[model samples]
Target: MIQRVIQFWRAINAHLSGSDFDFINIYLNKKEQNLFFAMRLYDQRHVLNVAYTARRLAQKDGGSINEKLLMKACLLHDVGRTAEDIFLFDKVFAVLLDKYLPKTAHKLAKYNNSRNRSFWKKRRHALFIYYHHAAIGAEKLQKIKLYDIAEIIKYHHAPPKYGDCRELIILRKADSLN
Candidate 1:
């Protein structure tokens, strides 16, 4: 699974870069390079689902967010999991709570409820790999001055309920399709 995911990531990166690593990819490599590499494995149809959904919702809602940006957020949302298991984020989250976050990051994990914990906690425990990663992803987008795109990242988890923009709606749909 790890190797297969790596191959998938390589294909997408090859498409995006058109040859090799870009300046941004290079910088990501320096920090969390594994996450950058892992992004290549994201399913493209799932990515397109986000764009298509965003387009559909945008017609009803308002403005359209960047399809590419939303897709990128969907693909990269779970990259943090690369640090934990390279295949799934839930195991990574558990490992983080047990060893890293409290000691290294000096933070304690807080969850919504037992049901939510059982739901999301078991899915991706060690990394910022789920809904919250949407917000985390939004922060990254904000750094690039794409706050609207960031909002898409922020709401991908909740969809129409919390998703305020067309792009976020798209992201949620794409994620759901996956």
Candidate 2:
């Protein structure tokens, strides 16, 4: 509960400094950077926090972790939530709906093809994106030939199972922390 409030406050005040861009540029190339920047500023800030937390978790784990790949995956984990698909209000609405009324949220998340841009469809689309952003992000990354990173992003939100990769575990932990 406290963590959620802290995250909300941080989101409202999210901003990136010049050095943050320098950090991002270190892990992402021009095309990847474009995708990263396409997200809203709050989402950009969230990914940066995820990347930083992921690196610290990797350092603590002290295994044969690919730090570069981990950093890249963390930075682009939320790349699916672009400005268009789910804006600020949609994201908040989806979060609250999922938290308070998960059954309803699940029903809405199931996508139905509709040509009209009605309010209900917008809510449904937001829930769908919220639930499946990882897979959506993976597809986008695949289009840009980021197969390895896409694989990590693809399962970032999946349930933990036996033989999960160290990078994926770290990314999930970091994401939850933020």
Candidate 3:
């Protein structure tokens, strides 16, 4: 509970202080830039942090890694979370509900997208995205034909049994670090 509160505070802080992401501009192409900018300010900060961590880990590993693709995967990993524009209170409520009344949480989140729903209903939609953003992000990436990055996003949260990709493992670690 305390950890979540701290995380919430950090997220709010990140939202307030926007990220420039100028350091990575040279690495990303125009399309990737568009995608990166589409995310909310808080998410963009988080993505940048993750990318930094991934880069450090890759350097430490000293293994052959496609740095560009690894960075792309890190950038777009949470893009699907932006599908619903969620506020801080909504996120807090969702986390609490998910932790305690899980069944109710699932029910509310599942029904959140009904037309002309209330604020709480919209919050439920945000919660749904929180739980399933990885898969959702992977789907979006697939549309852009970034199949390799899509696979990494799809399995970042819960890796497959035959996980042999070092980049995927590094991405997961970096995400957790942030």
C-alpha TM-scores of all predictions: 0.43, 0.93, 0.85
Name the weakest run of 10 consecutive residues (lDDT summed) in model 1.
80-89
User: Which candidate model has the greater TM-score, 1 or 2?
Assistant: 2
lDDT at position 63, candidate 1: 64
Report the lDDT of model 3 for residue 71.
87
- In Å, residue 91's CA in model 2 sits off its true spot by 1.6
C-alpha RMSD by candidate, in order: 10.4, 1.7, 2.6
User: Please, what's the RMSD in Å of model 3?
Assistant: 2.6
Q: List lDDT for all candidates, in order.
A: 0.46, 0.89, 0.78
Residue-level lDDT tens digits of model 1 in 1-178: 4644554454345343322244334223343334446442332223333444544565566564654555455544444233332233343344445454545322333333333455544343333343244565556556656565555556656627642655555556555544
User: What are the per-residue Cα lDDT tens digits for candidate 3 across 33-82?
Assistant: 67777777778788888888999999999999999888888888887776
Over the stretch 1-178, how does candidate 2's per-residue lDDT look in tens digits? 6777787788889999999999999999999998899888999999999999998888888899998899999999999888777777788888888899999898888564465768878778878989998998999999999999999999998999898889999999999989
**Clash statistics: count for each candidate:** 14, 0, 0
Top model by TM-score, which number? 2
- Which has the higher lDDT value, candidate number 1 or candidate number 3? 3
